[model samples]
Target: MKFAATVRAAALCTAVALLPATTAGYAQVEARVSPEFARLFATYQRIKTSYVDQVDDEALIRGAIDGMLASLDPHSSYLDGTALQRLNTMIDGNYQGLGISVQMEDGAVKVISPFRGSPAEQAGVAAGDYITHIDGRLIYGLEIDQAVEQMRGPAGSAIELTIFRPGRDNSFDVTVTRGVIELEPVTSELIDGNIGHIMVNEFSADVGSDVRNALRDLQGQATGRLTGLVLDLRRNPGGSLDEAVALSDLFLSDGQIVSQRGRNRQDTIVYESETVYRGDVAEGLPIIVLIDEGSASASEIVAGALQDHHRALVMGERSFGKGSVQTLLPLTRDSALKLTTARYYTPSGRSVQEGGIEPDIRVPQLSDPDAERRQRLAMRESDLRGHLVNEAGVQDEALERDRLDDPRFQLTAAQLEEQGVTDFQLDYAVRTLRRTAGTVASR
Candidate 1:
């Protein structure tokens, strides 16, 4: 139950290239608040009535709406009517706008990374690019959220963005046409001769079955005992917790997978791997998990649980460390609150918040080859920890080391960048499975 488990996992569940999905429960509950919502409603009334000069009714009501949604949780929140429509478009995975996921950094609007193959990337927008102008209106002082509101608009429209590319002084304008960007979840195919690779961009609804079907399809084609299974979770923003647990059960058996602890005494919950794991026919099959900073939430749960239980070999840099669970608490109207409800722990009782789980053998992905790029990166050995999500306490520190420079873990992101094949991480995983060929005795 990491902070971004739902949002992050939602990104990975994007297996739409392999699957499709949303978040909503308790359909019986109406979109209207009860009289019992006194604390919030009363505050709204008081603000509207007592505030200085006559307030704009619309603004006051919107403020009240925002407040109601904010109180629920971080993921759940009130989207104004117009905002709601845009959200629909965003989730639909297609929209006319700059294809970039942004965040507020240092009080300025900064681009996290341009979506691959999008207009932005075609325009050469990199991961850490910053926007200094929006159609010539200086954006240096705008907040990231406010800047995002300015960047989106009708389909087929075009926007000129002045980007402050890192390491360069002269800003440049890249005119990008707004187009529909489809986020892919799962991409599978045969590689390295008969080895079926499932690059799960993220986990989403029903991915459990999709994964099973994918495995079955690949196994149907392969002659050998599925020589290797490489699960590429690099940059995979994890999704649903249930999906994470279900996915874990696909490979694990008879052990604690993950657990959660809330502030209150009654809120603790533990998720355990089932005794019967997918008919047990795939028993002893090797699983190699690939992870990175973008691989978080449900992704961490899967990797951590497998690694902790000695079920799989986790390869990659330390994970994104997003172990706080945010539950979307629905409110009246079409809004909801994504509140951080619980903190999760690995099978060994380690929290992944602040400090993410340390991989048994660390392999870092270098997206750049230039020496300049290396200076910006730092995978400190001090950053390693046993925490799975947010739950604290030692469990299995001696089991593995966050060995970034270990000889056992080869084919890092930097090497992949040099060879021009980002799949080197998975390649390493496949190689490991090939080396450790045979049934894995259940511990």
Candidate 2:
């Protein structure tokens, strides 16, 4: 769930070859295929002829292409058939399935997150849970796409998943009914003390407009006056880059929002405030952005912009650092290439490639019993096999450490429930905002 772009009409061809030869003035340059290509063809011929069993030409070629892209980076890959369809569905914001984001980790299907209000979440599927069986069939060695395919079926259909939670002693089974997942990109509520809590689930189309409308609705619902705001972005794997810029523009009046640079100079682009929207929509309300390890791509973009501009106080853990931009280049009618094209920088010129947008105040989700263990096993951009390195050379060890065992956060999940606090992060943020509601100063 990252940003994607359509292919441009024109491409710049500025590559030039230089050669040094016996003649000092000018040397002729020859253009030919590299010897590695010959080796690849040789391997393909060997696989076709000398293999014990007959091999399909298409499969071999596809494997070669996949291998080539895999060597470059994790994000660059071939998208065809179901993969292409899934990408389109996510951007369009609706599908029929048990909505959960998963990945292949060590040949096991690991759950990244269950979308809020989705069937999987309602069925008790949590992050860090591993799906070992589907419909009573073992699926340990299946590909992630294959597992996802099995989990998705017609709406109202029931699917049984065997989940192995890390902290639990034994695996458990849960039957989840697949339903039409109409993803609400933005959701809002007027909490106690007249604080507006806006949860941005994803950066899909019209997210900025939805958030703007949500703010209006919350303002209308407040009894006295709108005290403060909480922009909840936790577990929001990102989408549309344009939407991220638009969302940031709602709070920033001037200055650069984000900038991206690629190999070609033409690909270098800068997004500034007032280009998407006019001015600050909050009207100087104290705001807090909640992020976690699941907040990625577009989420980081908005967080970085707001934090850099001093427009909001960012709380929660460091984000899932993914600063590169992926552009979807169509190869055929039903196929495309999701290739990493550029690295984006924050308004302060900080590249959150490996080191994500660090919160101004680190806050842990004390309501979840397994939050401590999950944080230790969480994966970030730096954990990927072939991730792009930040040119600024950030060291993860230098970043602020987690406060999982903080003395101030001694209340257990059971204790928090007894106190009627479901989400400690949002509760803490709301209280913090109430202390400085009308006195908040913005740059």
Candidate 3:
């Protein structure tokens, strides 16, 4: 079966959300009617009865629900109809469209990242690009789901996107042909000196098993025994939390992978290794994890776990800092609430809220001409309006570290291109692995 089908099958058998359903009955809790609630009801009544323009009850109700969640955090939202379907589409890991993870930023559709090897990426859709129009239609005030639905269509269909890139002088148009985006969560190749390079594009269904199989396949393709490994999570907007734990368990024999703490006691839970996978699949291999500003949620979980355990040397820029656990609370068969329930922490008890996973080795991608400019303009969790403050009292200055210039990474995109270096960070990682392998062999 396809991975998407596998996810649906798993969803049917287990709780739809990452956490189990609460057993406590509502009758057991004390009920209190506050004055604020009375005010809300009064306002609702006024809106229903005396509004200048007639607004449907459904729209008004949904708006009230959305407003309540909007005040809490950026991740929490009321999912129904197209929104719920989009969420399911992400979990399914395949869709016929220009592959991109997008979010509404101030009523504009902002590209989080173009999926690696997808038509959007090939067509030059970039992270932080504002999608202003789809096929000449203004998407300024449209819901994110509505805009995304307009973008997605049958395979082989062409769509024109008007993009407003931050660094560019003027808005541009890009026509891209939609294709079947089969999300291969894990892809690996045997690099020079028998170093296995695995790029995890997303955390989808059976990703842990897929990664394990990829490692085995890479090992088989190697001329000699694999000396090292590079796990790339760059530009990966995370998915299923179950798969995150499972993937981390594949590399860690024992110890806490991640912990979630919430207002409720039931939400406080810890996940450990050696539960999903028996032992480290790549035992004794020097591993490096690559992360960047786009790597979030589940990606942060895996990176933070391995880094805290000293199992892998994390490299690249700081992560997207989305540490909150979003629970899918189904209100009905056709609707659900994507609510932010808990905050996740690394093994060392580091909260990944505003403060993301800091890499052990900081490596910058110098190959992209707009890398520096984009880094400065990139929107992170902390930058989002109404974002939850870090419990550990992280300062705004810490999150603004990306704005500082690094002396080590002075190479321009033109210089790198002249030297035939497409991906500077990956190239540096590969070379580092080779050097480590040589040193190990000498011993």
Return the top candidate by TM-score: 2
Q: What digit string (tens of lDDT, one per residue) describes model 1 on residues 1-443?
A: 21232343344234212211111111112124355545544554566578787766566555655555444433334444455555555545667777776644444565544655677778766555668888999877563446888888765888899977555657788888877677565667766545667766556666666777788888888876576677766655566787788778888767788898878777788887773255433566766777765566778888888888787777776665667676643333554444666778889887777566666666654444421332234221123232222235334453224422455435545666677676455656666676776756222
Looking at candidate 2, the ten consecutive residues that score lowest on lDDT are 12-21
Clashes of each: 39, 0, 0
Q: Give candidate 2 regions above 4 Å deviation.
A: 1-32, 166-171, 441-443
lDDT of each: 0.61, 0.83, 0.83
1 or 2: which has the higher TM-score?
A: 2
Worst 10 residues of 3 by lDDT: 21-30
Instruction: Output the number of the lDDT-best candidate.
Output: 2
State the local distance difference test value for candidate 1: 0.61
Clashes of 2: 0
Task: Give candidate 1's root-mean-square deviation (CA, Å).
Answer: 9.4
- Report the poorest 10 consecutive residues by lDDT, candidate 1: 19-28
Clashing pairs in model 2, backbone N/Cα/C closer than 3 A? none
Cα lDDT tens digits, model 2, 264-378, are 8988999999998898998768999999988889999999999999999999888988899988876667766678889999999999998898888888888988887777766
Cα misplacement distance, residue 392 of candidate 1 (Å): 3.3
- In candidate 1 the C-alpha lDDT for residue 44 amounts to 48
